[model samples]
Target: MQDTTQSDPNQQASTTPITGGEPRYKNILVIEDEHFIGELYMRALTKAGYNVKIIIDGPSGLKEAQTNAYDIILLDLMIPNMTGMELLKKLRDPNSTPNLKSKIIITTNLEQADEAKDEIEKQADGYIVKAEVTPKQLVRFLQSLER
Candidate 1:
């Protein structure tokens, strides 16, 4: 067999592509179970011109979601209690958050495309698999909410 692929120095990566959009969120809520990833996202989103708040557990995240108003929420489906899916359902309820209007984005390590699609259909603005996305990608995702 012979090598036949073109070598382009400026070739783009095949990683997750971030879609750009307007500045919709001034404040964002990040609900992640993993402390490291939560911190990582907090730093990235903050640097992206969006104020962000981090919650490590699901219940606390739910409480915060109910009490405070944010432009968007970065949620993780797996948590100790009050799972992200439940959080999403609560957020979608008209009575759960009468004054809430934050767009929810599911962020997890799940590789299942069906799960991501299900979340989108359930009201998540977007989905990002943590292990599969970069910091810049997360930041750009925050930017996407602005649209």
Candidate 2:
């Protein structure tokens, strides 16, 4: 059997199947300001047997992400209190916050210029436009991440 718990600070998740066909990443954190979208993700992900938590603002999301060890973080760009880019900078900066093991995936409806988009993609594990994807599609994406 593979070891699920990570000893390395840089790698993301406790990625090993426990029993049956359960996914490696069981816990997920969603940072989104839109109530409907957050709820939709929570509902779909929970139903799929993954634990999910949703934060409405970037500050709270950053704080929670810093303090806890979530397997994945679904971040929105246009959020209250702070921007996702700012949060990404802080989270990815080893000098500011070290030993962050969560996989941060950018989930947003906002469009970015070529250079900006390249930068965002560089910092994050994955990027998905919220307006283009559904809750079920997001769940599938998460599952694919485990592979």
Candidate 3:
């Protein structure tokens, strides 16, 4: 990535209740390769009062991220043509269009935390393991995104 960090890694995160108080984010962009997971996330996030858009492939994800104005971006590690890291790199580059300021997060199944550890050094707002996150937990996860 192009080094877009503005905060330290150990920053504290706060969570809000799920009983419909007020949403911290309105627009969310989910970039994943699996339609099943994308569909699930779409349903969950839309129910959470987010205007969610899903892109099922990496190239499409990149294109969508470039064109759509979003408040948050969810990325999956594995995708066709371009990996999540490459997509992030493209987003962080100054030469790209859209000039994204939407907070970014990665939801993936990759085990190589050391190899993936470099991402935390980048500007991702959050990271979650897909297998470990439940639907309800995902809702809470979105809540914590306000942090």
| Candidate closest to the true structure, highest TM-score | 2
Worst 10 residues of 3 by lDDT: 13-22
lDDT of each residue in 62-147, candidate 1, tens digit only: 78988988888888888777777788888888887788788888887866568657666668778878888898887866665543
**Per-model TM against the reference:** 0.77, 0.84, 0.81
Q: Is candidate 2 or candidate 3 better by TM-score?
A: 2
- Between candidates 1 and 3, the lDDT winner: 3
TM-score of 3: 0.81
lDDT of each: 0.77, 0.86, 0.78
lDDT of 1 at 127: 80
Candidate 3, residues 88-113, lDDT tens digits: the string is 77776668745788888888987746
Kindly indicate the candidate among 1 and 2 with the higher lDDT: 2
lDDT of 2 by residue, 9-83 (tens): 787755554333676799999999999999999998898889898999988988888788899988888889999
Q: Which stretches of candidate 1 lie over 4 Å from their true place?
A: 1-24, 113-116
- Quote the positional error of residue 104 for candidate 2 in Å: 0.9
> Which has the higher TM-score value, candidate number 1 or candidate number 3?
3
Best by lDDT: 2
